[model samples]
Target: MTDESESMETTNDESQKPESQGRMQILDHALSQARKKIISSAKLQLFQKHLRPIHKKNPEVLKRMHMQLTKQLDCHISEEVMLMFAEEQMEKILDDLDGVIASQKDNKEEAWRPSGDPQQDSRVYNISVKVKQKAQLQHVLSQLEQQNTLLRDHVALRQKKLLGTKRTVDSGISKWREINEAATSIPADELVEFVQKYGKIHRHHTMIPWDDDIDVLVNGSQKEAMSRALESLPEYTLYRPPLVQWKFFSKNITRSKRPFAWPYIDIFFFGENETHIWDKANRYTQLYMFRKADVFPLQNKPYQGSLQPVPCNSPRVLSRTYDPTLCTTSSYTHKEERSKDPGSRKTVKCESLYRKFPFVFRETRDHYVMETVKVGDCILYQTKAALPCWTESP
Candidate 1:
């Protein structure tokens, strides 16, 4: 080859190599920043999620506020944290009050090596817990009785309230033991089976500040098809009749770092193309355009969840049309029309969630029921007691 040609080829390879290296470095840096931000932010997010009421009145109390949160119903905690706390509080905080004992009949102990102090038997890193009859331990228990009388009363009171629905969950959040039971109630094997048998079930944590239940996701095309198919299944003869329609919705933001996947189970049913079913279901759920999809799936791999319905045989399945061609709006004539101005255009974009679907298709219903779990699986699939269709949404 000629010397000039060789030089030219060498230059091209060098240039391309640097550019490729630079792009990779840039992507890596961006990913690192995002991970740091999300993991750090998750700590604070967890705190906010457990504690209800926007602001706590006193700044001074905020120091010990988290510790003393159980008795004072003035504060609140979610089920996830309550479960963690319930396991620890009795031996530490609720000392002398012989009442805070867990009556679980099962003796299944989790076996793991200890990392910290080797006083009794169990230890995990810096936290070491042991069961023994020490000398001053009795005195410390006495101090608990005197200093924290509210501990015993609070324990009994919450146990009594465990019979109700919302209260059971709320009370569980109060004692720290709630989430453990919640987690244990549903077995992991059962959950896996349900997800495998049904479509995907995403337990997503959305942008909503206060933590709710898992974000159940499902696909669009298959969702419609499955609604019709769920009818033939004989197991679905639990309470309600067969279903005909179902709806789906993504949250208001996309590409946003989510809070806690470890803490809660998000039963998501994803779809490939963005479906306007959530918008139409607003008529049924009474929700405004509160949530929106931030990102689109690569192809038709949208997440479809079991919450979408199966056997096409539930009491609640409505109708929906697919319009995946463009980001255009199909016939949507609202009674509250506005004037012809730039503001109207902006408002439409905002109301329709900025992300428009090609066709409005039609409205649908989401009447879901939990079916049986996998063999030896203890997973509890949540059924919507009632649909939150935003019909009166302004």
Candidate 2:
């Protein structure tokens, strides 16, 4: 039994020895690989250190060395490990390269100097510092130029607005002066007689500065006479409408820029109908009928520093034609006053509608009525009547 046990123990020892030999072989192979990897890393680091000075001058040497190192460490080291070492070596090489470039730049700058005196060196250093400072100043100057350009544009815009306002004011003054001159041209007796025979000057402020077109009214009988009188004047040009009243444009008074185009004075003519006053130019046949005596006996009123003919009962005439509230109110600036004045709001609507559908309806003293034509189907016809009486009072 002892001999059998000893033989069995020997067999077990033999099996254990083979397992230990396999592990030893593995360790030896791993150590050899580790040593090779360390050697390759050391070589790469040394090569990179020497490569910086000649990197620009001898690029072929760097390429050959890179190829050899890659071939030697290809499978011996993991790809990640090799890349990490390569990256570290590359960073060191870049740092050394930067240092060498800086030293070369300094050598070139020193070579350009005429002398190595302390003051000369200080001047060179100051010149470099000033170059940097000049660059900074140039950047700031560019920004300021942009800001200045914007400021100039803003100023130009404001100047344009101011000039436009000035031109408007000057034109308004010139127009007002022309209108005043035209109104004063007519003889006082003829003006008074015309006003008494027809209608008074409406919305003529006696003691205020009026900057609007001059308004005149005449009856059918006086229309030809007034037109002849206006046409006789050298400064006035009579604009005769087909069915409407005539307008008097001033030949002498023209815009500052436009010499041929002139501003005109409005002349309103009224024709008495069965129930209302008809205005051919305004296309409105309906207007409050006034007694001949109510608008007669014209009174002189101050208009732009001159006396002009006005109705004897101007307030009554205004109230009858336009709004009753206008007689009580001195100004029409307030919202409440404007709201109370139907003529002001209705006039705009009527004008807008008239422009849209010019021949649809005719206004009577009471309301608007559709105008009927003698067609087979009785079509509505628009009249070309000019209602100067609808002008708003200030």
Candidate 3:
């Protein structure tokens, strides 16, 4: 009996050993992460303190610095490195200021020294010192401004490169996939679905390139539920528009409320009836309209390596939303918030789309005709007085 009990105890001890080891490993990892967080917080505090005076003198520079810091932080860089870079910048500014101050002081002494007229000398010396300090401060501020601009450009270039990388683009798209999966928890009748929108055209052009945001369409009724669900998500923060409009409502979901929250999602709430669905007619001169069949019976479309539920007839929906010619032509995206400068716009050919789809063209000396291809057939033709427009031969 004694031998059996000892054997049982030994077996129990062996069984618990693996579990105990796992617990220790987890604990160690937690501690390490906690230490990093503490150190990062301290460094950030110190950096902010260094900028406090500069912020008081020139708030705009401080704002730009904060923006740069936000972008770098998003890149998963260590706060220690950022702090060091900031210190170097501050040091340079100080060095420039020191040199200017020294030169001004030397000049002041030579030009306005103690004279026989004490009162006059005192007034001139005070005014000179004030003017010298002002000039020195301005000079230092300009240097700092230029350095900030260069830093901003460098970080922006690095950021652009990072975003263009396949891994980063995949990661960004995966986030939308997660949101799509989470949205499925809602019932089908409520109509929560991701739509291709402008991104649909890009599918023919590029291999799921990084997009600024994703578009989601939900029934007007599901607004509250979606708001609650998105808020519950750890990765998403839902923002509702400030003003309420008839038949128009949207929720903007962002990763964070930072200065450069690039990749986000827009959830547009649509009003529906038995025959048709529409959004924001009063707000938009050309409201988006769709037949009930165009949206119902949501179909899965391949997007960014995942099969996301999209409107059944995406091309039809897009045609109604944007100019039909947009399918054949490519141009820089125009957003309401962006500057409306014609010089900034460029027209480019949808080479990928043109290649993938068949089209017939007619060329003449004065004009050309081009036909729009849909579903492997030439459907419509348009004439233009430019380089040979490809027109569908009837």
Q: Which is the leading candidate under TM-score? A: 3
What lDDT score is found at residue 51 in candidate 2?
A: 80
Local error of candidate 1 at 94, Å? 39
Tens digits of per-residue lDDT, candidate 3, 216-275, equal: 667888777776666666755565763432121123433234322333455677787798
Instruction: Give a tens-digit lDDT track for model 1, residues 1-394.
Output: 2235545654554454324233334434444444433333333334445654543555334435533532233223234334555676633453333233433335477756655667643334324333344446887888888868888788778877765666755543443232222323332211111122212221210111122232323343344333343323332211111232222212221322422122223222332323322322323233311122211111111122212222121112211221222122223211112233443332132224312211111233445222322212333232232222232123
TM-scores for the candidates: 0.17, 0.33, 0.40
Candidate 1 weakest lDDT stretch, 10 residues: 294-303
**Candidate 2 lDDT tens digits, 1-394:** 1234534644554454334334334444454455444544444435556787665678667757766765666555566554764776754665666667667874644455556698988898899999999999999999999999999999999999999999977765665555545545555433432221222223212211212233466565466667665566575577777675455665765544422233455567666644334343555444535544545545554333345565555556656656522222223432121234544432233232322321223343333222332223344443222222233232
lDDT of 3: 0.54
Off by over 4 Å in 1: 1-150, 158-220, 228-394
- Please name the candidate that would achieve the greatest lDDT relative to the true structure: 3
Of the two candidates 1 and 3, the one with more favorable lDDT, higher being better, is 3
Candidate 3, run of 10 with poorest lDDT: 383-392
Displacement of the residue 388 alpha carbon in candidate 2, Å: 23
**Model 3 Cα displacement at 83 (Å)?**
60
